[model samples]
Target chain A: MIRFEQVTKRYPGGREGLVDVSMQIGAGELVFVTGHSGAGKSTLLKLIALIERPTRGQVLVEGRNIGRLPRRAIPAHRRQIGMVFQDHKLLPERTVFENVALPLLIAGLRRRDIQRRVRAALDQVGLLDREQARPEMLSTGEQQRVGIARAVVGRPKLLIADEPTGNLDPALSLEIMLLFRRLNEVGVTMLIATHDIGLLDQLSGRRLMLDAGRLAADLGLH
Target chain B: MRIWLARHVQSALASLGRLWRQPLGTLLTVLVIGIALALPATLGVLVRNGEAVAGRWTSVRDFSVYLQPGLPVEQAGELAASLERRPLIAAVRLITADDALAELRTAGGFAGVIDALERNPLPHTLVVRPAADADDAAIAALADELRALPAVELVQLDSDWVARLDAMLAFARRAIWIAAALLVTAVIVIVGNTIRLDIQNQRAEIEVAKLLGATDAFVRRPFLYTGLWYGLAGGGVALLLLLAEQALLAGPAARLAALYGGSFEPLGLSRGGVAAVLGAALAAGLAGAWLAVARHLAAIQPRV
Candidate 1:
């Protein structure tokens, strides 16, 4: 669950990332944030992950205010919310299994448990056969799936993605979206930021539209 | 507790594996540390061996007390007996004038010259050896006490060179300490700089790890272990260098000792000395890595 109340994010310079944006996504909901390049979708997720703090108001997760969370507590907060990136932010030198195991490793899971969970998460992303393959050796679609497996391997309560299918073809994008849909069905809260308008018609979820760092629309679930 | 130990072991081995993968860089860094450590270690060995040799030489130091002319042999013998009774005196042998003249006639090759004199001129003598544990000051004090006796004319100090050698050894010991301090610092800096470069090369991996909820300690574990490996390997190399140096000097040292009519064995580090060298290397490595990690790891965060 995530709640943002009148949150504004201003950068070091005069530019603003988000202005008076407020929204709430209940637990187990699948939500999509859609906007242009500078529309604050990434900023909203950044605030939730505590990568950057909201300049004003409050950002809550599971009814706890994270705006004033201490610096030392940030890692634990980030661990609870799995994050995927457009660039597949996997360590290129490592194999798919190693990349997926990163989150669980941070959690200090036993080697046996880590092996079990990583394999299962890779299976979910249909990357089971590519466990030992390096990121560079995988197709773009496969790499993104590996990234997804990493984000979910720790069994995070909430999962966030920033243009996860941005580099893929439509068919691959649809496949990635269907994979996300399956994950959501398993009761993981999902907040994905994307601007793929064509893909949105084929997938069903609530949409929050941003314009000029402001929340312009909140389309209810279809 | 088991988990903690397992994590530490895993981190240490992983760091070692990384170094093994990049053999050239690791070897170069380790070699520099080894040479730095060996400089001080060699100096330590020299000072220790020098002190041991000085101790042996000083233990045999002796002085001679010359009695006044016309002193009766009975009184000279009584004076020698009294001197020998002192706690600092190791042994005393009285040589009467007749005995001294006879010894000079047999061994000095000056029998004709000495017989040309109308009277035997050699004074009664007390050859005095100080106790083995007596210091230079105590030996000098004893000599002064002997010189103050009414029948004693002069006290000849034969161990002045021994005192000078002890002074030189003391000075060398101090110099070794200063040199060892400077070299230890050099070792620390070498390790720190190497670790800094390593952190720079792994910037991406660090950022990714941090983003994946890795704590600062977790991210720093490998680099700390990297420093540890460098220190341990460097220590090993230093021991080898010390061994090589001892081996190289063994024959020459023995020959020099033979020339002086004494046996010499070039000494290597003692068991404690070995432990000390390795301990210093280990400490330097850990400290260097800790400083680098503290300075650089905090500056890195996952940037959106």
Candidate 2:
């Protein structure tokens, strides 16, 4: 459950990053946010994650206004959401298992429960076999899978991916999208921001398109 | 609760591993802190020994109240008897001028020279031993009171040298404390710098952890513990240095004191004092680590 209500984000250099963007996604829904590079898709996701507050208006998630969350409470808010990046963002020195277990570690979960959840998440992303392998040793697709496993290991209510497949090949991108679709079937709200429109058909659910800092179109869930 | 304990242990061991990975650097830092801690410790031992020596020498302290020339022996006896009646006076022995001259003549090996003198040159004197509780101020005050007597010409206190030594020792103790304070500050800077370098080296990992929702406390735990390790090691080294100094000096000091027919036992640090040193070092290390982390960790943010 994520909602942006007339949110306008202005950068420090007198540039508007997002303008009057208002949208809502129901619970357990998977949506794709498509726009050109720097078209405010990332900004929308950032606002939802509360990493960047709107210059005006409010971004609400799970019925609470995230923009208004106090500074001390930001960690709790962040723990409720899972984020993935295109670069995998894994600690290069850590093993795949350690990277996946990072979220559960931060949550102070029991080692046994963390081990089980981490193995299960790694299994879901088809990375159970490479638990001890470092991210640098893995292929780009495998690295993205590790990132996905990390993002979902904590079972966050809202999952945000910012151009997660931007560095992958077409086939790898499709496979990752299919994995995401499978995750959607098991109930995880997903918001993915990507410029790649070619692989949209395979995971087509809904597409919200942005143009020059404005929500230009909303292709409702089909 | 189990999870919390597990995380604490995990993080602590992880931090220990980090230090173990950089053994040479950590060892160098610890050595620097050890040298710094040892400087003050050495001076502290010096102050203690100085105090012991002063106490030993000052035990024979007394005041010589000399009577005016031509004073009668009966008058001197009366003066000594009155002096012994004072509260500060433990005992007073009266020596008439004639007796003083005769004793000096025997000990000075100048009997023929003293016999040629027309009159005895010495005056009647009262050797006043003070009470055990008489301090430097009290002794000086008693001398002042005695000098005011009609028959008393001069009051010579044998405790002045010891008093000067005591003053110098007290000043030295203060100087040592000042040195200790500066060295403590140096330790803090060393630890703080070490932690700062660590934070800089782990910048990427720190940013990633922040993104993954690691609290400031979690990120800070390892560095704090690492600083404490440095401090504890340094303190242990300082303790060894102090013990080594005492061990090396003990036999020689005893022999030298024996040559002078005095037993000089230089008391080294007590158990509580050693604990205090380690505890202070630990606290200083923790403070330094806290300052460094608080300053540097907040600047690292996950770049979205």
- Candidate 1, TM-score vs. the true structure? 0.92
Residue-by-residue lDDT tens digits, candidate 2, A72-178: 78877888888889897899999999999988988888889999999999999988999999999999999999999999999987889999899999999998888
Clashing pairs in 2: none
How far residue A18's Cα lies from its native spot in candidate 1, in Å, is 0.7
Instruction: Tell me the TM-score of chain B in each candidate.
Output: 0.85, 0.81
lDDT of 1 by residue, A1-222 (tens): 799999999999968999999999999999999999999999999999999999998999999999999999988988898899999898988999999999988888899999999999999998899999999999999999999999999998899999998999999999999999999999999999999989999998999999989999999987
* Per-residue lDDT of candidate 1, residues B74-190 (tens digit): 999888888888889889998899999999999879989998999989899999988878887998988898889899999999888878988998898889889878888888888
Scored on chain A only, each candidate's TM-score is 0.99, 0.98
Docking class of 2: medium
**TM-score per candidate:** 0.92, 0.88
